[model samples]
Target: MKTSRQNIEIEKGHAFVTIGMFDGVHRGHMCLVNNVVKLAGDTGGISVAVTFEPHPRMLLSGGDINLRFLTSLHEKEYLLARAGLDHLLVLDFNDQLRMMSACDFVERVLVGMLGMKHLIVGYDHHFGYGGNVNSTTLDDCAGRHGFDVSRVDALVDGDVSVSSTLIRQLLEEGELGRANSLLGYEYILKGRVVEGKKIGRKMGYPTANIEPDWQFKLIPADGVYAVEVTTGENLYKAMLYIGTRPTLETGGNRVIEANLFGFDGDLYGKDLTIFFKHRIRGDMKFSSSELLSKQIAKDKDETLQLLG
Candidate 1:
């Protein structure tokens, strides 16, 4: 449960470690973690996970900042803890660590810093500077380091490999049901409910707006979703909207808005976690505000039924 910024000496004991950025910790990642935990249990080693912060992609490419995220650090930690892991090592993704060669990474970070006796990586394990390291190199390195390696077989369901990218694609395509199935849980996005133009309220569909911590947190496709809204304490069945308001005569600014069904309470400036259950409809351009309002009502009813 200890989170350290400076490197801590790897406790002098055997440990099973799973390595990845683990952005969403979706089904595939969970598989790896579970495998490590089970293996560690058999080997009398600690179950540990190594993940990077500020996703390496963001550090590598300063691309579009608004990619929606499936989970925040707090969410990831909570999920991992629930999965029965013993330790979660969140390393800072910085240039210094990035420069380490594959061999050095295995020796210094995984072995020296983590004291991993068994290393469990995904089927396609690649790491080190420029990602030039592969499975062969890892096997050789493990042999030299006197540790065990477990390469988890690819986790696939028919045409789809359970992956963070696949989950992101599903979300982008508004495939909430399929995405949730692959994720093994509801796909959630964490953000603080912030102030917004009072457009939804004026239209009689008040919204609790969300502003995520990372701009690059990948958002699902622009659509209305059946959602469960949690503001750290209370959970509510609701309709969540993620899109630019086309009906409102305004500049196109993408926004995340959620309408809690049959619940009225102040949510301004509070953090909210939205769990997407199903996609109801794609964002649309209505002929009139009245038309948009009518559609919103229908969306609400659909979401209510979905929750039920």
Candidate 2:
């Protein structure tokens, strides 16, 4: 996919576009994006996806809010490129863009900049300041701007709607299966190996301590999880721990660590990606290091079975 940060002037009436933050690129987003691609093909126009950087919430709240994201900008770009889009335009979410009214946004960004002949959006999506603009308002703008609009219905699983918010909540609650089902893939965390206290090594279960690359990436709840670890073109079945070392006296900040079963390698400073498959158990404090070690062995056994 062709990607650009600066606006490019496209031929009038030659592009079919969709606009959203598209966090996670979950199943709900895939539904709308697939339609955009199909419509673009049918109309012989370029399929353009317009997204904002730093998330609108972060800018709107002036960095006061502790908002986390499911996908970083690079991850979002990679997923959208794999989804078969013709172009991905990343707009900077700054004060100037935020101040644009609903009508001005349509005329300036959609019509004037993108030359959008057709616009596709989610059924409940709203834009502009305060998110007061809806599909009806877009329809009015489409009529005045000489463009057409289409809204894709929400993708629902059972009674719940498939959405980024719901996925985040599920992950926080340690509901891995449902969250992965909504995402249509395993939830992933990417990071670089960092140094930690050699406590696990003494217990005969060495681990790689991970420091997430993105500061605002959403980490699931503190617990043990069955995960697939990817590093240097090799995949390993691993048990991941995300919590403070409660069994130790020096327990302080939360740490993300993983033990790769049946493998041994030096991973200091190397990058690794962990794909969460299942939640094994919640974090717990043990009476001694021996108790924690025994429990970790059980967790590893369960992880192997789950991965198999």
Candidate 3:
């Protein structure tokens, strides 16, 4: 997909667009994106996914909020590209854009800039100054701007709407199975390998300590997980730990470390992407390192079985 910072001119009335933070690009977001793509095809227009960088909440809160994201900008871009969008426009959610009124945003950005001939949005999607604009307002804007507006009904799983918020809650509670089902894919954490105390190596299960690439990227709940690890072109079955070393008495920050099965390498300073498959167990305070080692061995076995 072509990505743009500044709007490019498309043929007049040839852009089918959807707009949102698209945090996880979860199933719900995909519903709208896919709809836009289909609508573009039906209407002889180009499909465009318009998202903002740094998340509007981050800018609005002046970085005071503790909100974490399901996907970083890069990850979101990758997902949007894979979703078959014709173009991806990332706008800077700066003061000037934030200050624009609802009507102004519609006319200036969607109509004037994007050449939006048709707009597809989630059923309850809202935007513009303080997000006071609603679907009704969008319909009115469409009337004046000479375009069409369509709303995709919420995608639901067992009566609950599929949403990024719900997915985040599931991840926080380590409900990997449900979260992945709603997401239509496993949750991923991307990071670079950092040096650790080499305790896992001593335990005979070497691990690559991961420092997440994005400060706001949400790490799943503290636990051991069955994961698929990808570094460059290689994929490995792995067991991942996300917590402090309670048994080792390592009093420090929480760490993300992954032990790749049947693999040996120096990964320090390299990047690793982890796709969480299942929660093996929550963080535990074993009475001894020997006990912890045994538990890890159990986790590895369980991981192999799950992955297999």
Candidate 4:
């Protein structure tokens, strides 16, 4: 996919566009993206996804709030490209753009700058300053600009709407199955191996400390999880831990580390991408190192049985 900043123009044919933060690029977002692709394909036009940088909330909050997102900008671009979009237009979102009325945005940004022939949006997607215009009102704005508009229905599973917020809640609650089901894929974290206190090593379970790539990336609930780790071309079944280590009593900061079964090598400085598969159990504090070791051994057994 061709990524363009700010304004975009198609040298040949028309531009069919969809607009959103598309945070996490969840299944709900994919439904809209797929529709755009289909429309563009049927009309022999270009499919475009217009997204904002820094997330609208980050700018709107004016440094008052630190927001976590499902995917980084790089990850979002990669997923959109794989979803079959012809172009991804990243708009620089600032105060001026945020204050623009929904009607003006439809005319100036979507219609004027992008020359959007067809506009697509999620079922409840809103427009204008502070989202004054919703999906229903968008059609009238589209009529004024002489462009077509389509709203993909909300993807519902068991009476709940599949959304970024829902997935985030599920992850933070350690509900991997529900989150992964709505995401249409496993949640992942990319990080570099860092040195730890070596307590796990003394207990005969060596683990590599992980430092996540992005501070704004959400960490799931503190617990032991069955995970798959990928580094270079190698993949390993591993058990992951996220907690403040009440047992160790060294510091208050939460630590993320993994022990890869059957792999014995130095991991410091190496990058690893962890795909969370299952939540084995919540963080537990044992009275002694020996007790913790026994529990870890049991956790490993359960992890192996689940992975197999």
Candidate 5:
């Protein structure tokens, strides 16, 4: 797929377009994307997905919010390309676009820039000047611009509808399995291994300390989890720990540490991604180091069983 960043004069064509932040690119978002691609392909039009960078909230909130995200810009681009879309346009959510009304957005972007023949969106999606646009507003815009508009129903995962917001909530609540199901993939945290105190090494469970690549990427709640660690071209089953080492003397800042099973090599300064699979247990404070070590062994066994 072709990608174009801000300020490019797009050559207008018969295009089928959808616009959104598409955070997490969850199953619900994918449903709408698939429709856009299929509609464009069936009618011989270009499939275009217009997404904003840095999130509208980061800019609109005046940078006062501590916002976290599921997927980084690069990850989103890869996912969109995998969805088989023709074009991925990354727009800046600047003052000009933020202040524009629904009519102006439809005229300037969907009509003037893309020459969109059809517009697709998810059920609850609304946008333009404080989310003033919805299915009703889009229909009105389509009448003016002579473009067809379609809205896909919400995709349900188990009992609840799949959504980026819901997935974030699940992760924050330490429900990794449910969140992964909603995402249609594992929740991944990519980072570089950093130097850490040898607490785990002394316990005979050496771990690689991770510093996440994106500062605003969301970290799952404190817990012991079953995960798959990927580095270079190799993957390994691992038990991940996310919390302060309360059993140790130094228990302050939260840390992410993963113990790779049956592997031993230098990992500092290398990039790694942890694909969270299952939540083994919540963070707890043990009475002594021996007790904590014993609990760690149990966690590892449970993680290995889950992998099997």
Candidate 6:
């Protein structure tokens, strides 16, 4: 909760800053942020992270129909704060600012606007209009702007680079183990628990349903998952489903429904966080409600075993 909105000025001092969209604040990003903090600590400087709002890709693409955010601003800020950053600057990614030249961007924004004394950027990171800016030019701009730049190498898993895109692909394909490895933690979705059709309760597997704030937030591949559910107040082991209920003839809108293992109360309208642990099985359509109920019972057993 330690954050200040006022523009910062480091008087005759050094500072560590890294720039990125920091989409999910995944493992790779944590490595960069942690390094920045470690380096800044030794120099008696602040560890600052500079991120943009409304993702740059969404802007450049004229708004993609498939565009999804991994984390909302509130989630991103919370993650960054937990990673021990001294300050976070969430800049508005407007068209005017987006059109600046690489050199101009470095001189003005990195040095003038934020007063960054030292910058840590990823090896393959690009910036400025058209993303034509590279690390070499960043160093050149740093020289002129009276700042220093260090390139953090890409974090890799085997031959694959640990990136937001790769993590998204993993989640989309239902590879929770690999995704969690790359993320350094389970992938989690946060939303407000809402009213559902009450079908689960009738079937004996009562579920708490979450309605997402953003329609375009990417959901993991449709499947059953062993999960840990959390509210701001408590955590519970649960089984979560992410998909359109094929067996129930529920069309299109993907539902995130979870059955808390051992407790129940009126949770409708409460904020819920579901942490993905493992993929149980791919979603399937059943011939009858009875058959579907049988499968769900089996899924619950498997989930409880997984949790153990």
lDDT of each: 0.83, 0.90, 0.90, 0.89, 0.89, 0.85
Better of 5 and 6 by TM-score: 5
Q: Could you tell me every candidate's TM-score relative to the true structure?
A: 0.93, 0.97, 0.97, 0.95, 0.95, 0.95
Which 10 consecutive residues of model 3 have the lowest summed lDDT?
58-67
**Tens digits of per-residue lDDT for model 1, 144-249:** 9888888888898878789888888888888888888988898778789888887899889889888976566778899999999887788899898889888885
For residues 173-216, what per-residue lDDT tens digits would candidate 5 score against the true structure? 99888898889889999999999997899999999999999988
lDDT by residue for model 2 over 139-205, one digit each (tens)?
Answer: 8999999999988999989998899999999999888899999999999899999998977888898
Alpha-carbon shift of residue 22 in model 1 (angstroms): 1.0
Model 6 per-residue lDDT at 303: 96
State the lDDT of candidate 4 residue by residue for 211-240, as single tens digits. Answer: 989878888999999999998899999999
- What's the TM for model 6? 0.95
Pairs with steric clashes in candidate 2: none
C-alpha RMSD of each candidate structure in angstroms: 1.9, 1.3, 1.1, 1.6, 1.6, 1.7
Which structure is stronger by TM-score: 1 or 2?
2
- Candidate 4 weakest lDDT stretch, 10 residues: 6-15
For this target, which candidate reaches the highest TM-score against the unseen true structure? 3
**Model 3, span 8-111: residue lDDT tens:** 76887999999999999899999999998888888788999988987888987888557898999888888888888999988998999998888899899888
Off by over 4 Å in 2: none
**lDDT of model 1 at residue 69?**
67
Order of quality (lDDT)? 3, 2, 5, 4, 6, 1
Runs of candidate 5 with Cα error greater than 4 angstroms are 7-11
